[model samples]
Target chain A: MNSFFQYFADIFNGVKSLLTGMKVTGRYFFSPWEIVTQQYPENRKTLKMYDRFKGEVIMPHTANNEHRCTGCGICETNCPNGSIEIIQDKIDMPDGKKKRIIDKHIYHLSMCTFCGLCIKTCPSDALAWGQEFEHAVFDRTKLTKILNKPGSSILKDISE
Target chain B: MKEVINLPVKNIEEEEYHINMGPQHPSTHGVLRLVVSLQGEIVKSLKPHCGYIHRGIEKMCEKDTYPQIIHLTDRMDYLSAHINNHAVCLLVEKALEVEVPERVKYIRTIVDELNRIASHQLWWCSFGMDMGGLTCFFYGLRDREKILDIFEESFGSRLLHSYYTPGGLMMDIHPDFQKNVKVFIKYFRKKIKDYDDLLSGNVIMQLRTKGVGVISKEDAISFGMTGPTGRGSGFSCDVRKHHPYGVYEKVQFNEIVRTEGDTLARYLNRMDEMRESMNIIEQLIDNIPAGDYTAKMKAVIKLPAGEYFQRVESARGELGVYVVSDGNKTPFRMKFRTPSFSNLSTLDYVSRGCKIADLVAIGASMDYVIPDIDR
Candidate 1:
């Protein structure tokens, strides 16, 4: 008789525990207020990120077809991944003063770890985040971008 | 069929059987090797061997700049990469005396909480698998995927997101991050019941966990366990609550703790902690303060000569970082006091005399991530 009672008591305790757990879960299940969960891609219309959120690096260009980068190569030196490369040229000015110009500012996205070391090390605050995260391409080489515009010289205001 | 007995039999004496437990076993949770001496089915002694996955992260940090070293931290505790990044960033920010914006602090707190939830979810799933319940693994992963989706949408990467930076975050919070997080909390809040019904209340689970791997509060303190491991043993050691870094000071949430330092108590403590993290997230997500995310600092961030130590409550335990700056762009020496290393040390004391099968249960209860241990 004692053994039978023990079995029933054990079953009763098991059921009680299960019911108690279900009650806690049921409370949340019926609640009107839900926590944050946004479906991506489909919810692109409602998707939002920080404006200054660091995603990718880009060079700033002035309206006069000039850029702020002046072949200083500070970013290239600071980059741990060797993602940034700079090529400089000597420009002969009409005023008889030769100026160092950035011929090419190559940024290899493939090798870049996006540590933002390059942007932080820039003496000229000319490099900034472009907010372009969808940079996936068919070929790895396509990720390597040249930041300097063709036939463009350093901005006179920044260089001075 | 009976084989013929050996003609010459020597006098038998007492001998012990030594079994190597890992460096490759699933229950070890990374490349942790344990040498166990057994007397029949009972374990007599156990020795833990480490350093299989050590990548010399301290040496690697010397070669990289302040910003580049953040990536190295991501590899230390992959589950709580954001928190590790936060620790490094806080150290650098302190060295430079840069004050983070209120908005940035709030955003960092939210991301850290989300990462905490994801880490706990993975721990729950992996722990379940270690104990032979495969169903709980799927349930935990299913819930964890929701948190990962939010991270991927806000930050470009899912796991090793080097998002936190010195002055503030790498960028501002995603526009819809608040709303998305709210939805996730609501869904997760409801899903906790399913987890309880499936695993917590199960008779088999209770039998395996409830009274096993018991540790006293005094013993826990002596062993230096933190987070849920310490909390479950009745120690109130939560960095968010104690130190209150970022915006955690503004948020209201209970620090889940249990007096019983048993495997069940630890499991229950984490479950309650997950709920508390959700509670904190619910209150802060909608009311984020508006301000600049990044504080203005010099382009080349050079730290002053000083020693700074910052501690954060990672999902595993207390993750303390000690950094020495020699007024250079990079730290002179960076040392990490990882919780897994200390927590893993307690396993031998707990596992002795227990059945070999119970070793897995004790290990799973400790929540030892081997890479964190090895690093």
Candidate 2:
């Protein structure tokens, strides 16, 4: 007789627990304004990534067509994935000494792991993380980019 | 044709069959295949077949510098990415004898706890969804996003944050980091009650989990289970409590343990662990010191010739990093004693004789991340 009563008690407890759980979902059901999801594609116009987002490596070129990189190739050596390639050419300086100048700073987006090592270890603050994250391209060759603007030269007082 | 063709008699109870659970099943959660042998609906034995997602991270570590290895560690156990980075950082720091700033220690500890909460939140939701309750999936992710936002503002990546370098953090905490963390703590404290009401007290959840996947305390220790899985069996193996790396030594919190040694106990252990993590964060958030984020170190980090081991309590379990340095820029041989592989070994032991349907629940309760296992 006692076991029979206990069986019914267990069922009652189960149903009560189910009701309590439903109360949580029910509260959210009535309040439709409490939704937390942001429609991704629809909200793209208003979307802004955080300032510190490690999107991609970019060499900032000034309006005067000058960059900070001195062709030291520190970033090239520090990059774990061999994504950065620094080609150098010797130029006759005003002091009659041949100084190495950067011909092209090539960056391969496909090979870059976004680890920020190249940016952090750059000696002259040459590399910075760009805010642009949409790197998808239909062709693979498009990912290999020359970071320095066309015909850009080194900054005058930039330290190596 | 009555030619003495005698057929062997089949035993009624000896029927056993095998089925592959997944390399792609959602319940397995990340490309883990289990070969389950069954007699009727009862699981006779279980075998986990890993290496579907192995990336050879340990091999990659040999070629990379110590600072570069932090990124590789993040890829292993991506849920507890911060703690994984912390393990490698601590290993290098101990070997180099670099005393990181107090600020760095406080920030690392707080971020570690936040990562713990996020991991446990994901685990709880996934565990709940695996057990047929879908609401937990929404609630858990809803809260987890807040922590990710904090991470993004400070560390620049939502997941796979290589924030900790060898000697100290890669950068100082963002100006709003403390304020944002406090807001999250206050907000989550209220929501955790809802977690209990929605799932903890639910009789159906208890019925499915209680007394399932029972592992003895001795068996748990023998199997080398750590973190919440071992804590569920009352095998007090929290590396934070025992070893106390970072600023964990200064913090006050209880190491939650349960003696039930079952699926429900493991489930509850993580649930309580989330609360304990909050307690840890609340204790340290207001008292962070003003100092340098990193220590003064050379441009290149090369540990002296020796072997160094450092362990930290990750969201899953104890993540130990072993580095053998022969006085080089990179490690001679790097070994990671990840927790998931050991925890997965016990699945076959605990799930034997359980219904095959319960195997999903058992596996979920263990919370073994597969990439950590393969790595």
Over 4 Å off, model 1: A1-4, A11-71, A87-112, A119-160, B1-14
- lDDT tens string, model 1, A1-160? 9999999998887878757655654665797474334577798777665555556799877777788898889899878779999988898888999988888999998888766767766777879877677788999889999997777777777877
Instruction: Give the alpha carbon lDDT tens digit for every residue of B1-375 in model 2.
Output: 668978999764589888999999989999999999988889998888999999999999999999899888899999999999999988888888889999999999999999999999999999989989999999999999999999998988899888998888888899999999999999999999989989999998899899999999999999999999999999999898888888888988999999999999999999899999999999999999999999988899989999899999999998888988999999999999999999999999999999977899999999979999998
lDDT of 2: 0.92
What is the docking quality class of candidate 1?
Answer: incorrect
TM-score against native, each model: 0.81, 0.96
Error of 2 at A35 (Å): 0.8
Residue B221 Cα positional deviation in candidate 2, in Å, after optimal superposition:
0.8
Give every prediction's interface RMSD: 4.8, 1.0
lDDT of 2 by residue, A24-110 (tens): 999999999989999988998999999898888999989899999988888888888899998999988788988888999999999
Chain A TM-score of candidate 2 vs. true chain A = 0.92
Against the true structure, what is model 2's DockQ?
A: 0.80
Give the C-alpha miss distance for residue B61 in model 1, angstroms.
Answer: 2.4
List, residue by residue over B1-375, the lDDT tens digit for candidate 1.
999888976433245788899889998878899999887777778999989999988877877778788888888899999999999888888777788888888888889989999998988898889878776676788789888777877775678888887787776667778888888898888888788876788776788888788888888899998989989889989888989888888888888889888899999988888888888888888778888888987666777888899888888989999988897887888899999988887888887778888888888888887778877
